[model samples]
Target: MSRKEDGTLVLNKTKIFDTENCYIYQRGGTESKYWQFYYWDSEGREGFRIRKSLRTKDFLIAQSLAQREYINIRAKIQNEESLQTLTVAEMTNIFLAKKKLDISSVPHAGITPETYRILKNRCEKLNNFLGKDTRVDHLKRSAFKEYEQWRKDGYGGKVPKTKTTIKTELSTFKSIIQDIAIKDKRVISNAPDIPKITIPPSEDEHRRNHFRHEELRVLIGTINEWKEEKTLRKTAGLHRQMIACAIELMLNSGIRVGAVRKIRWRDIRVNPKDNPKQQKIFRIITIPSENNKTGKQYECNCEIALIVEHLKRISRFNSPSDLLFCNQNDGKTFSSRIWADCWNEIIKRSGLEEESGRRFSYYSLRHTYATVSLANKVPLQLLASNMDTGTKYIQDHYYHHETEELTEELNPIKRTRKMTADEMLAQYLPQKI
Candidate 1:
């Protein structure tokens, strides 16, 4: 309908072209033979674009050809059978941008960063190895096994990557290409299966990441000491206390650090239904589906009921909408900063850093809650549900081999009185001779 500056005038922009971006446009003048069907096609090696060709001399014929080509493109997209013509680098950028948009678009998702930095790094490594090229289309599904070996053995001058690391990268890679291919009308269904990689028994086998009861007690005592020493009218002291609260909360409730950071004062209350007499603070922390990773509402009971009550009394933000652990300055959730500050200080001051064989972070609190609960005879399925994970994962990854706990359940052997040495010798010798 309109002529583009220094470009061809579009004959018409109709519904047929909107979804797939395929339409008719004349290059120079509106000569009928100059009419072209600008449609997406994988006929040539240039990996996917508005593939143009002079279809007919008549405008009406051009429209018919364009529509037919668009139909074929749509069919290819729906069937996921179209050849992907995008370079690996282009797909990587699109995928990362999409991931950023997903997090930002969702409110109260609890993830603070827009960048998936780790995944980005992996993608970059993939780009470096694959050369950011259209040759990515030549990646044969049959060659996936060879590619896996090349990844493991450091072939083609690429750095050797671990199975877990490579698996994550390949998953991202698969997701990216499939999405772009479908969107670009290159493919229609799910991407072909990438070869599976095995996770070694020792891969991330830090099963001792949980704290023992005595150690947890020591850590709590240290936190209390920290509160006493660090307590001041200044904002710094309050944040430290908040961090300590977060640790205690995670230790008891098995809530993730991400969910803990998004807690609001409005979400907490004493449920009278649970406490009919209203004599006790039957406190509850409501995790909304938006804030939780599982997208399920989880009501976490107060791990330390007294501490929860105390926080309620002394909270700087008492309003319903106020964040429970806000940054003292901005009045926003302090989850992003909690790890870099108070958690580090707690580990150092408690001497846990030097003693723990494995590195422990805020997540260890969740692990500890599960471990302690399991050791004390809590049901495995119940613990898994509480942890928002599977029973198999609990058995394989988080559960500690606390042999001492098992000893208590076994029947004790009765002790026989020791026979005198002469009586033992006579009994043995009579039989031996």
Candidate 2:
């Protein structure tokens, strides 16, 4: 068959489906003209090909039916596509490609950059367990447990992987396999069911506490010192300075690292709602769904205007296309995922690297922001909205009051500009709605 430039398809002898290895056939003698469409049936590998009768002696009618059936097969292959069609490795690659696409662009399923990193890691685990080339349709659904056990055994049962770790790996494996499988009906049931492995509460990692004020101070001061030191000593300091800016940004506004890394100069506004602009206070940072984890674009009133100003002044390129905190060495975007060396090192240097107590990472900065904001009586309802997190989460997790005396320092006498519910909706929402 030939595909015309005007997008019309022309039928040719023998082959009907362009993508598949399909062709027309006839019984015994050519004179009989009992035409039939013979195509390879991949439904299971039990049979080599399926023979379907076009039920017509007329050549034109047989061609028409062949085209119709060919189209139907092509649609199924398309819907169940795995590049050249239905193999584990090709499908996994496609799935990861889609996730990376979602991470970089809009109209995504909210897979964060961190989540994409994890997905790739999970794919590796699956490949190690089952060879990447294994046909997805060939596996028995119950064999998932055999995989769970195989991971639990962990290479001849010597260096046993953690129960939590093994569970996560197999569960992710099952998810990727099942997602591709049943979406196009590789199996009968509501997807091939993977048996649930019990993850005991005792084995779960605890929720973290926010960084102490002193720890935050030390970290920031140390980073600032790194930035100001002499030229030779300040080589590594450039990256640290970027880290400090990222910390300050997240500390004032609870935007995650995944979202923060994508923020370009064009996304910021220095108090656009205020006349003459208030440089002393936080302005605004818009986190759109393409970068943000929540998959929602929203405004954040943040004190990072000063920080942003400093960054632009020091930045090699201050154009709208340039990122806020890029790699100091190469001026490229940092991190395959968060927790670049500087963050962990700084936390360790700050002496916040706890052995048993609450641990702090780059995410701790966000938690610290929420904790400190709540302590300042920033209004819990508004804080949750501003953070783009749940009010219930704030109440349950981050609402521990530090001290009553510390709260008195704010002295509610000074007027503050906080957006009311109606005002917030008016600003963030489209008026056409």
Q: lDDT winner among the candidates?
A: 1
Native-to-model Cα distance after best TM-score fit, residue 276 in candidate 1, in Å: 12
Give candidate 1's whole-model lDDT.
Answer: 0.69
- What TM-score, over all chains together, does every model reach? 0.60, 0.61
At residue 67, candidate 2 shows an lDDT of: 82
Per-residue lDDT of candidate 1, residues 1-433 (tens digit): 7675556566554445565446676655545546666554444344466556755667777777777878877786666555445667877787777777655424455333634655677677667656787444555665355556666677544554346767777787677667775454354334556877888775656464777777788788998998767454678777777777778878878888878888888887776667454426446788887777777877765445666766666567768898877777788877454666677787788887677544568888888988888877889987776667889888877788877766645534444557768988887675744
Pairs that collide in candidate 2 are 282-302
Candidate 1 local lDDT, residue 431: 70
| Candidate 2 to truth, TM | 0.61
Query: Each prediction's Cα RMSD?
Result: 9.5, 13.4
Model 1: residues >4 Å from true position, as ranges? 1-88, 104-118, 124-163, 181-198, 204-209, 214-233, 271-282, 335-359, 377-401, 411-433
Error of 1 at 34 (Å): 11
